[model samples]
Target: MSDSNKTDFTNPSTFILVGIPGLEVAHVWISIPFCTMYTIVVLGNFIILFIVKTEPSLHMPMYYFLCMLAVTDLVLSTSTLPKMLSIYWFNSREINFSACLTQMHFIHCFSVMESGIFVAMAFDRYVAICHPLRHSTILTNHVVAKIGLALVLRGMMVILPFPFLASQWPYCRTNIIPHLYCEHMAVVNLACGDTRVSSYYGLFVVFCVRGLDVIFIAMSYTQILRAIFSLPTKDARLKALETCSSHLWAILSFYIPGLFSSLTHRFGHNVPLYFHVLIVSVYLLVPPMLNPIIYGVRTKQIQDRLLWLFTHKGI
Candidate 1:
């Protein structure tokens, strides 16, 4: 057999992304809400990035991490949503094998990248609260830039195998992906061959990136609380804690829905397909929409800047 035939014989030329298996009739109606949410997602994250990049005073460790988070959200949502909307609006469900792999790559890479940014933000809060006198020295521009690059590289290294693993397997079974987006495991699960390796790798990457990040984020916040309580006065303690509130909200908004969706998909045997699909949809849209809101509402700098931009037409 020739190389091209061997490639074709190994993997299907394309895969069909079935959006909400049981709710085919409602896909058109469903697109309305999702379209609205995606609009908010795009506009909101871009606004956050715009403020961060344009504001000279905001060029610090905290906002720099926020900017990275925004970039991830922007890329992650863009990677998944266009295909999703096409399926809904145009009823275009066919995705080429390579395109599916590309989508899977961006989805996993950006999600892991966002997880690292959260960890970075947690460290920023820890330093600002626990060691304010040395915060600047600890989180210099050079240090933050390096951290950002390292996070992206870590994500790239860990997720690089996702597509390769899938391609190695013989997808001799059905090519219908159950979920809306081309998630790594979703593509892997369609393989006719043994799926243990792909599944285990997916879990391994999640544990290594998100799991450890959560652990360290918890530790950082614990220390922040200890330092806050050690403050000399009530006002001082409250002042210190106030700075951490936005970040905690951001963490909850990003992780809670994400973990819930992943768990429900994996273990919720009795979950209806519509609900499972809805959870996945929420996981993708919620963080992009809420991160900007969380920061805008809780951070004085972002809030004031937003107000000034609106009131003064950005001067």
Candidate 2:
């Protein structure tokens, strides 16, 4: 009987996602803000893509990277938000095992892709500011396309192991994931077998992808700052620095919350489960919603384009 029960428990077909462990009563109220944010993320990123595509003048490597970032944000948020809303609104928490793994793949894959896009954007800024003469020659349309392809492949390869490993894990324990979506670690934790390999590999992926991305971005910006300061006039330096303002805001908005959510999940023992869930959820959704607004408000080109779009074309 005991053996049969264990066999039945191993690798159950479905997992139950407990939205916000302690805040179930408030899920309805909480979803209002989340829904609003998701709406903004979708519409804002779509508008960014549309504007970038329609305006010939905006057809540059930098804008290309921006469009990639916008698309990544769209995928990253869309992977988790709809199901989250379902969990909150309709009490639909059951997820098939394979479907959960798919969600886990996309949530992490696009996240890594977003980090890569930031690195690409940073490199674009570096080339534009530091080597203005070679900017066009260096990052031509072909090179930009290759970069996008490489980033997509890189993200897909790095995250491919996550779902495979999770599926292989002998899940003899309960399948109740105490959070919104199928977070990779949360799913892995249910395994009755050894999890050290998966856990360490997860850390390895984070370091290799996100940690290295941060390092590359920092290096690019260091050179960018050095180049800006070397300009002959204050106005020249200001002009060069101003071009990076939107990108800087986008980086800070995305990385800060991401870092916090990661740290709290791994190290914040005393933190409430509900709080952790909320932070992670917000981290995923807020940046996508904020990126377009930052660019539209801060980038003079985007601002002008938006104005032209609304006033002249009624878009």
Candidate 3:
């Protein structure tokens, strides 16, 4: 009867990571862009943090949410990219089970927190455009602090169970995870025992957090449009609508890739695992790379400060 319960993950000492399957010959080429993007992500986010902290004019509710976004982006990218690079550049794909779980935990935690920040940004725009006078009272320093704390708390609570649940299962199948990063689904699929409960919960969380965030962000923009159209002059309408462009760009950059990858994974039966991994990687990489660029190009204050900082050699 003991033979009936054999599992490769009885203790699960180590796991082999398969970075970009079927493209082993091109790993070097792949690493180049991934490395470049990660560098850009780190540099851009830190610059945003610096600009937001130094510029007093950018210290309002909108920029405060942007700061939170930057922080989440930094942590999330740092959590995944180094390990990915190790696998790609050095071929050091072996990772301890505990370390793998820890990495997955942070990835999910920071992802959820990033979504919360986007939600907060949507609310900031809603108040600023819809109720300019009440924006101050509604989104004070204390309130922003509380919201930030709640975001972190919610992320910790919701994602903490993921790795734990994944770890509980005995993985008799191949210990090779076919992805650049240790994602929840990819890791969980290697388990030998029942995974339906954990997998369903993961899906439910994705729907609850990501689906709802997208819906709310869209709703917020709808109201913002109504408010802009109600303005007395075309110039006033244009000005109000322009303020939303940066946030809209951010939302699209984040959610579109995620949703596209998710839908294709579910429906694209012909799609190979390598393509799926590629989609997931792109899903994670795009936001960090594009968010700062969006802010720099779309937000006048950020653009002006960026140019001034470069020219003046000081903030």
Candidate 4:
């Protein structure tokens, strides 16, 4: 294939990304939606944080995890959406190499932290449902604090290497990252050196971090299910399942598209640019947009708090 027809797989010293083709015009279509979503994500998560901080009733382990999750979502969305909007609204798609690496690092960090929050939430649910009497004892304030610290440390360990690995490669020519944000793999793929070690390390980290979290979540739900099934009444089972409905939805919304996008990027690079952009946008934006709505509608506490806050504000 001619150079024009070939995908630039080699790393160049500098990259120039002319916004995705056809998307330069399509930015208008996404601008309002993206802005609205960003507003909702930031505001919704802020309210959750505020309520969790101020409300004595929400001082429990579950709410603590919820607060952490809200913080994670806020940071995660901030890590990408601002630059995305800048590119869309102002047509400023250029990003410095160091800036790209920094963005990629935080994106990976917050994403891994979110996974850890999910795992902690699952454990909270398991303790609450499976061993109700001991829930408080098992998930104490100190324990939760420890878990939070561990999550941050673990996420840093997993994601810090990605930027380091990327920095080592000499970028000689093209700097245009096709995607809006500096995705770890996409950035690494631009490196001109032997990326075998980076690729393998990335794969290992992804599976170890995300994969283990998924396993623990699955196990937590399994135990909760068993405990719920042993209860005598249909009403009881329904109520028990209802408690987890929001969490289940959040997990599905966050994980499915993410895994699909990763798979497509790895194996389906031959696909059209539109498909790639569409899948990636969905992976990045949809979860941030949907998370608050799903959790708010499904969790009675959040719903009631949101209602009260709105009523007081008269908006």
Residues 167-264 of candidate 3: C-alpha lDDT, one tens digit per residue: 88888877788888888888888887789887788877778878888888889989999999999999999999899889888988887887777667
The global C-alpha lDDT for each of the candidates, from Candidate 1 onward, is 0.86, 0.91, 0.86, 0.80
Task: Give residue 300's error in model 3 in angstroms.
Answer: 0.8
lDDT of 4 by residue, 14-47 (tens): 4444455557788868778878888988887887
Highest lDDT scorer? 2
**Model 1 / residue 2 / CA error / Å:** 27
Q: Rank the candidates by TM-score, best first.
A: 2, 3, 1, 4
User: Model 1 Cα displacement at 168 (Å)?
Assistant: 0.7
lDDT of 1 at 8: 34
Instruction: Give the per-residue lDDT digits (tens) of candidate 2, residues 128-238.
Output: 998999999999999999999999999999999999999898887677899999998889988887888888888887777789999999999999999899889999989
By the lDDT metric, which is better: model 3 or model 4?
3
The candidate, 1 or 2, that scores higher on TM-score is 2
Q: lDDT per residue, candidate 1, 168-225, as tens digits?
A: 8987657778879888777887777688988887778766678999999999999999
